[model samples]
Target: MSWTVHVGTILHLLDPTANPRQCLDRLWEEVEKWTSIDGIWLQCLPGHLQPSGTVLVGRCPDNADEIANLASPATASLNTDGLPVVARQLRDGNVPVALILVSHHHQPQPAGFLVDALSRYLLDRLRLQLEASELAEENHYLRSSLTPQVMQHDILTVSGLMETVIRSAIRTAPSNATVLITGETGTGKELLARLVHSHSTRSHKPLVTVNAGALAAPLLESELFGHVKGAYTGADQDRKGLFEVADGGTIFLDEVGELSLEGQVRLLRVLQERTITRVGDHRCIPVDVRVIAATHRDLSREVAQGRFRQDLYFRLNVVSLTVPPLRQRTEDIPLLINHFLQKCNRENYKQVEDVPRKVLEILQAYPWPGNVRELENCVQKVVVLASGNTFHEDLIPPTIRSYINEPHPLEHMSLGSSHSQDSSIPQNPLDNLRQALEHYASNAGPNIGECFHHIERLLITHALNKERGVKLRAAKLLGINRVTLDRKLVEFDLDVKRGIGVIEPLVDASES
Candidate 1:
């Protein structure tokens, strides 16, 4: 039999008759060098030596000549001084006739028939190993290729609102325009910012990020525009600010609404002049960085309240992207849940194979206030706590589990309400409404019909406010036709446009 030995290749059979005990010890030591595994198992006949079990053997780069000499068909007991060899007997229905050698990630052993055929043993093992290696490489390639697809799957939604947001983000990604992403907290503002940076021309450069809300005004200033040595109390060394670090790339300013008035001014200067001055130094350094700001706060409202500057708001609002809250895109819940489940399995090493239908329904119904971030946490929790392969309601966190199968008042009026037809709004809203009516009645002294009108006016106003002053949507929430809504608007002296109503005392105009 001919056996070839070379560097970088695995599999080497030692002399047929080697000192079994010593050979086993050497083989184990050698295998340990290649991978971390439990002690080796030696299976062989009791009499004259027979090799068996599994052994790992990789050629050494430094000593190929020595290896060839050791492996030469010499009538020697497994040469302890040269290459390592192992001996063992295969279990019932399985025998190691051909010396099986493997590296760290070993391939499956060939069938017993294939192993016994001396002529084809080497070729078969080599072919199997090559195929296994190729399969492993292909698997790695597929995983890497699927990464971006998974990300897109997680974000892309069936809802038109989310599709519009994604389309807008794509349209703005390639441009050099400053982008301001607004949404509720945990709505993936930073994630969208990263998407913009990844698709932009500046993708090749760094995308430095800083949370404006995380740092104080002074520290934040230093972080934005690097300070020179000795600029402040502990300014030991000159530091390059985020803008400088992101000179040819994009700088993501997260929670930008949290910036102090002074911080806002400095940021404004960077936007307007394309330059930033170090804290201590008066030198204005030109920067070619693109600014991508994100916040959960309404900057327009902030500007109105004198908290945010109008000019800065306009500068950063060059291309505004509003990431829809998860509740608004409930249709994507199943996709996201599955995506997160796969992610949890990989990260937590838990094989939660499936999510139960009831669990999925509950997850979709619950309003994720923390948005995608909250949903991710929920999935992770369930995966970690799941006792079996399937995720169940019992595995969910208490807060989410409690809400499962429970109806909420807000679900009744919102356009993006849950789809469970059997779910009815809790009577809490009605109870609260009744309490308000009694309080108002004691003060106004109105009769039954007039009181009913006042209550209808209050409900309509509430719906209109919730619908952001959209008359048609408000009418839908009130279960009334648009004509009826318009008449109610006039009767209550409600200005739908202003989202407020002026009601003159409910006079019995019929008595008049």
Candidate 2:
């Protein structure tokens, strides 16, 4: 069938080049010359609305309104003056664009095939052009900017500690030496590994990651070194392992400490010889792959205790990088909270604005056991359950609330009486604190830190109360800066109003 392909509205993409208006004028000029048509219809909506497939693009020879009416939902297929009009929707990056082909003969399937092929090529060209434009803009911005920017990745960190880590990772990424990432679980070890892979010369190749702790000994071995057909009971067909799959790329071995003794020997041999022998196979097949192993366990300790092999440990420890736990770098919490909140909000379709100051204090106070992973989960939980834009202290997990609810150590300081007011007590404040802790410890709660935090809150409140709500005076009395005193006031929810320091208890709503 003889057919003429017509371009419909291009969705999502706007002309990014300089002088878009002139470009559009020139585009129409070329279209008229190519199609031998005078003009076509063009519509640019103000907001992000899906383009109707029947909307005319450029200029239509027939009346645009009449054509739209003829191509309405009721008129699926049509014949206009012995010409068959077929329209199909094509998606470019989830944005749909309509492609119409008018054929002199009635051959719907072939016309559709031709339209789809043409649309695919158009979409591919558009994507390539868009990417090129973006890259050029990015290069220009980076060259003009003074600050060094991290490569585009999901990692969000403003902490100096993380900046150093990122710099180190970038520096070492090009090398082929095995990298050993040591950190507590959820500290973004795998993310760093992937970052290294992305920056490496072999970035164009595959990256296969396997969790050494997740599988049994035999399965882990088979997964790492492949298996021949009839090698085991379930081996119906020969299978390539992760090493083979990751050839010319990087293979990340997470929780490498969990590997059994035999598995360690096999891994060490592979690292040394750059080859692997399939299960039940004598032949040693050469494979080229970089190894990036990670674990929370201390490999040196494991080796000393005979749980892990010394040679294998040495092989993987060529370039060791330690990721610090979240508690040590609490300064990054605000940035992290903002990042994860935006993420969870988008994913959960919520509109959480920010974490309230009181809630931030609680999150900052609690020692994150699961590190960044736990913090992310906590943010997700709060966002999913948030009733409004602001996240309050009450939304925090009960364990945290309970931990912050200790007796303030300086509770008696507000009484304005010396410890000797009772003859049984020592005059020293430290003595008073010790006695208070002993009494509180008798109740058997989580830890001493929780009790100590209570004392800290009490001391700050007493200082504020003594100063009659003047932050400057309170900071001087507490021997701290105004910034620290302000933080303490927020942490303890100590509202200083009307010459009084009122402590707001972080009580669970259910209990209240």
Q: TM-scores of the models, in the given order? A: 0.54, 0.53
Clashing pairs in 2: 39-59, 40-58, 40-59, 40-60, 41-58, 41-59, 409-455
Question: lDDT of candidate 2?
Answer: 0.63
Clashes of 2: 7
Find the 10 residues in a row with the least total lDDT in model 2.
Answer: 66-75
> What does candidate 2 score in Cα RMSD to the true structure?
20.1
lDDT tens digits, residue span 1-512, model 2: 12234443423223446253333333333332333322234434344433222222222333222122223322244333343344333223333323333332212133344445445544554555554455455435433442335324546665555667777887899999899999999999999999889999989999899999887886876898899999999899999989999999999999999988978888899999999999879999999999999999999999999999998999999998888777545655666777687789999999875454546656665557799999998888889889976665777778767755543333335333432232222122334555656755654377677667766765665455443344544565566666987888777656664223333432321233
Candidate 1: misplaced stretches above 4 Å? 1-156, 409-512
Best by TM-score: 1
Residues 296-395, candidate 1, lDDT per residue (tens digit)? Answer: 9999999999999999999999999888777656656666776788899999889875655546556665667898889989889889988766676777
